[model samples]
Target: MKHTKVKDLLKSTTTLQEVNAKGWVRTFRNNQFIALNDGSTLNNIQCVVDFENTPDEILKRITTGAAVSVTGELVESKGAGQTYEIQVKKIEILGDSDPDKFPMQPKKHSLEFLRENAHLRVRTNAFGAIMRVRSVLAFAVHSYFQKKGFVYVNTPVITGADAEGAGEMFQVTSLPMDKLPKNEEGAIDYKKDFFGKHTNLTVSGQLEAETYAMALGQVYTFGPTFRAENSNTSRHLAEFWMIEPEVAFNDLNDNMDLAEDFIQYVIKYTMDKCGDDLKFLEGRLLEEEKSKPQAERSELALLDKLNFVLENNFKRVSYTEAIDILRNSTPNKKKKFNYIINEWGADLQSEHERFLVEKHFKCPVILFDYPANIKAFYMRLNEDGKTVRAMDILFPGIGEIVGGSQREERYDVLVEKMKVLGIDEEELSWYLDTRRFGSAVHSGFGLGFERLVLFVTGMTNIRDVIPFPRTPGNAEF
Candidate 1:
């Protein structure tokens, strides 16, 4: 008999007589009921077995994480939890999980312990819910752009250009590290490496995506991006997925509009499609927050928080205005901020961003028109000569969910800015050509895909959201 997926079986309006189901056993209760899940849905279909008729040998194999196939009659369940269940006629153990050796037992485990076994962590209810939400959100991201007539662009993972010029990039080389070839000046000769010049895993696809956007008019790139930064904070990851969208003839306002709509669309899509998983995660968050003080607990539930973002408009504030608000705020006044906001040019830290999003605005906030010296060189310089048309969308929990700006379109001004920033002009001549030839106003932003997942899944640590996270001093499978 053909196997019916757990998701479909649970959604069936009428129960069938003889249905085959295959899945891992989540738990065996009372030696009669087997909770089975096949990763199709968060809910498990209760499989009732006749313990008296079943042999002891077959019944003993029904341990957690064991794979099994059951031939049964799907019927309206009399059980309290599930609406439908399988009355097993025959069961076969495809694979057995030794309860003593299985790391994930039927009990609550610490997040750190689960992370160590990330390879098998998805089998857990929490991780399963998270990964499902992540998958749904990923599809939402693609669907949202595709429906908008945006071309999906595949940018190179390896590139010679440093989009941010941050110097913190994972260098890609094929030369022997122990016996690296040296030049006449005694410097390591990158000419002997792959690509005949220094190249690294791309930090951002924005630059290459811009090349396509110039011709395609509107395009977005969703792919893995590498950053060599060693920060081991909960928010930073060495390797992560990035979503970058570049559109031609867009100014700062258009960029903000695109970002706001894009985020809300994806979030709403995930919430709608993965309601079961989201509800589970919301309950999980509520339970986790119970240990904290009442005042520190979340004011709104996860679903409410998500809905609130979708319902309200993001508060748009200039960098200058944000600075004044921060300086006058209680945290800054009490010298509680780690990086105190003293002047306009001071970059906003996570503390400042959270305060604006969670405390003052009580909604997502868009901070724009940042100081040119503080923002990237590619950001469009405003007429004031001091600030750039940069924007960052700050979420309640996730500080900066999206960072983008109106690109500097003028050739001479861009070159001068690059020179002042000490960025090599010759290496980026290919990028500058877009501006040189026929550049109109263009803008884009890079959203950390994992952060979005973290927000949607209601997970605190960024590592928990991404599978097999690569953090500082940790690359375990």
Candidate 2:
């Protein structure tokens, strides 16, 4: 608590001017030297100490991940490689860390190894960069929405079912799984679940967002969204953060603009607000590693793309054109498509989406009017008898960062669409009733917060973005 935060260290003339700064040991070397990163700046303040001056007990207590505070003089170094360092006056022991027990160390390790110890991984340079940038991106979201007069609404996480209708929900029941009663069809009776009515975590907050938007005129909900799908992919997490902004008296076009502007704001915000953290990552991969893996290369490319796209405009492409373009492309392009997106009705795969945005548009492109059957039921139908008013903003590396649409404000159309989707109508009375009482044209979209972090920070895995990732077969702390 007595130490300065890592962010407060800005420049040598400013923070380094103190010379006698205190911080924990990120790593050590030469038995007489220590690297102190106060977590205030991207650069760590290197401290050189002779073993004679430093106590054996203090050195014995110290480890790679140990927490220590050093009071030292800022020494300007112009060695063959090194530029700046700190001359130690004395070092104090704030906490002792055992190297064998500490999860992170100076030696190179895989990201998978660190995922097992999330709580401790923040001490690492890469994760520290990611976590700090995540904080910045989240702040950017709130700042952008609030600055535009958008009310931040906290919607209910528990309620009578009726969100995504994915048939995937964790029963919040008091009864033991073995003791719960079953229907004649052998399904567990949800009546035995908590609240007596069926309920689970929400997959999306759009409906609740729309309700708030109707009253507040413009509202946004940023919270946790849960899905029960047992997916093992890097992009799929059972629990993740979602940002949904709803606007009343707006259509799909307005919604797209909002999504584009908001995304640009987040990326630019991270670059501006978290310049130090990103610079740390850039140095680690670019300078230290010589070059990075393909994924990391892709990540850097995206940061460059975001910097340009945020300032420029976005390209708009229709579903029909996207399909035709995919169909017309040559067969052998060494392109790895997750699935075929040719023809109007085929569901767009991640690969196809990446192609359209990265290849065709060459920038962040807004792909609109997706096929009705493939999209959510709330999306407004198109006059072309094929697509819905859904706009997905796809950037170069990450595909489909934003998924949103204009809702069918007309009660009759909404009800019909629900029927077609096999959803019962009576259960959603509160939502449907909104239509009866001045539910004007409204639009909103959900941007996966983790996806935004992955894009901004140049981290590849979604598991690393979330501190405790809940994924298939893996929920380790």
Candidate 3:
């Protein structure tokens, strides 16, 4: 018999005569009721077992985390929490779980504990909801780009170029580390590596995506990217996903518009499709926030915060203006910010970003025209000779949700910038070809996919948003 998903079974209008439901046993209460979940939804299906007729051995095996198949009549539940439940006629234990050994029992478990059991964490209500929302958000990302006539491009996972110029990439090599090959200068010989050159996991697909955008007019890449940074903060992940969209003939302003619209569209889509999951996450967040002081808690609920973003336009401020605002703000005045904004060229930290979004602007913000020295070499240099056409979209809770800029289309200017920055001209000759051949004014931005997921799910830690988070010293599955 085909087993029905818990999500579909719960939405059934008419009572079915017999239905097969297969799920992991969340709890077996009073030896009669079974709370079964199959990860189709956050809600569990209550399977009432015939404990009197069932053998003691079979009943005893129905433990938490046990995989069970229940053949039952679908009927209106007498339970208060749920409407429909299964009246079990037959039950089979597909996989037995020892109650004494199962880590995830039917109780509240700390997120830290669940992180250790990352493989089994999704079985919990909170993680299940988060994953579902994440799946929908991913779909929404592709949907938004596809509907707008954007071609989805798969950029290479391994590349010799560091797109972000951060130089914090995980090196991909097949050469034996024990018997390392050395050059005449005693440096490691990368020419003998698998790719016949130094290569690493891509940090961003923006540079590659730009090449496709130059020809295809519009292109976007959604793929995994790696960073070898050692920071073990809530926001930093060694491995994460990035969404980079490159478009032709778009300037800094156009890029900002595209980013704002794209983000709002995806957020609205997730809210529409994952209503139940979002509600669960919102409740989870509220419950978790109970331990915090009123001042530290979020002012708006999860749903309300999402709705607020959709209703209002993100406030746009120049970087110079933002620096002035930060320098005169309460935090800087009271020495609250860890990295105080003392001057114009200072990079804005998370605290400064939060103040602009949550305190000063009281909405999402777009800070543009950053100092050229601080931004990447690919960004278009402004006429002021000091700033570049770079922009960062700042959210209330998440500091920089999206970072992008109008790319430098002039080949001469790009080469000069690369020369000054000591970037290899020969190494990125292919990227420069986009400018060499028919480089029209183009723009693109990269949205850290995990950051978007973090904001939408209201998850504080970036690790929780992505499955199998790879941090500095921890790579446990």
Candidate 4:
């Protein structure tokens, strides 16, 4: 008989006399019951062994992490924890796991310890639930875009230009470090490199996605993005995934509408499809937060928080207005803010954003029209010549989840802005061609894919959401 997934068997309405199940053993209890997981869902199916009829050698091999296949009869479970379980008639050990050697036993493990063993961490209940939610959320992202007639674009992972203008990027080179070639002026010869010029892993796919959007009308890119920043924080990752959507003829207002609606839709879909996983994660979060002070604990439950986002509209405000509120805020007056908002044009930090979302507004906030000096060169300039048509969407727990702006469509304006910022116009002539030929007001935002996963999973650390996290100095397995 064909093997049935544990998820399907668990959801079965009728018990079967003959059924086959194959998975890795999670635990063996009282020499009779075996908990097995197949990565189909967060829940594991319990398999009851007839130990009196079974051999001692087979029972000893049924250790944690051991791969096993069992042919059994599905019956109503007598145990208190599960509704139904398998009555194993025949069992085979595909692989054996030594109890002394297995790192992940049926016990509680710290997140730090789990990070060290990331390759095998998926076997844990928390990690398994997180991965399932991540997969469902990813599908929701694709479904939301494709259903809206948006073309999915695969932008190149390697590019020749610094699209973000912030030059903290990882360089891709093929030349030997010890035996490097030099030019007449003793500079490293980039012509001999793989791309015949300096190139690096892309930090964002927005620029390339824009090219397609100009032609395709609507396009989105979902792919891995890399940065060489050395910050080792819970929120920073050297390599992460980014989801960027570009729409032609979209002004700042249109961009905001798209972002808000898109986020709500995908999150709702995940809530609908992955209800069991979300519930497990929600309980996990509550247990983890028990050590925190009462004041620091979340005011709403996980489901309530997610429902709040869908039920209410995000507060929209201008940068100037946000600055004014921050300047007079209690934190600013009490010197609690690490960097006080003393004047206008000051860049908003993570703390400031959290305050706006958690305390001041009590909801997600979309701040727009930021100072031109603080934003990117490609953002459309406001008539006041001081601020750009930029916006950032701040969430309750995760400060800035989305950032975007209306693109500068005029050739002369874009070129002048690039010149003022000391960017090489010749290097990005192809990008300029969009404005040179035909350009319209366009807008898009990039949502950090891992951050979205982190939010949905109720995971505090960004590293926990990603399977193999790449940080400043850690790249193990």
lDDT, each prediction:
0.92, 0.77, 0.93, 0.93
User: How do the residues 187-213 of candidate 3 rate in per-residue lDDT, one tens digit apiece?
Assistant: 999999888999999888889899999
Global local distance difference test of model 4 = 0.93
Candidate 4 TM-score versus the reference: 0.98
* Local accuracy of candidate 4 as per-residue lDDT tens digits, 287-376: 878989997788777887788778879999999999999999999999999999999999999999999988999988999999999999
Candidate 3 deviation (Cα RMSD): 1.1
User: How well is each residue in 1-477 modelled by candidate 1, as lDDT tens digits?
Assistant: 999999999999887678999999999999999999999999999999999999999999999999999999999999797889999999999999999999989899999999899999999999999999999889999999999999999999998878687548988899998899999999999888889999899888888888889999999999999889879788889999999999999999999999999999999989889998999999999999998899678777899889978999999999999999999999898998898888778878888998999999988999999999888899999999999999999988768999999999899999999998888989888899999888989999989999999888888899999989998888886
Q: Between 2 and 3, whose lDDT is larger?
A: 3
In model 2, state the lDDT of residue 473. 80
In candidate 4 the C-alpha lDDT for residue 274 amounts to 91
After superposition on all C-alphas, the RMSD of every candidate to the true structure, in Å, is 1.2, 3.1, 1.1, 1.0
TM-score of 2: 0.90
- Could you tell me which 10 consecutive residues in candidate 2 have the lowest summed lDDT? 1-10
**TM-score, cand. 3 vs. native:** 0.98
Clashing pairs in 4: none
TM-scores of all models?
0.98, 0.90, 0.98, 0.98
Q: Residue 345 in model 1: shift from native, Å?
A: 1.3
With a 3 Å backbone cut-off (N, CA, C), the pairs that clash in candidate 2 are 6-39, 6-40, 7-40
Off by over 4 Å in 2: 1-20, 75-84, 181-192, 283-302, 332-338
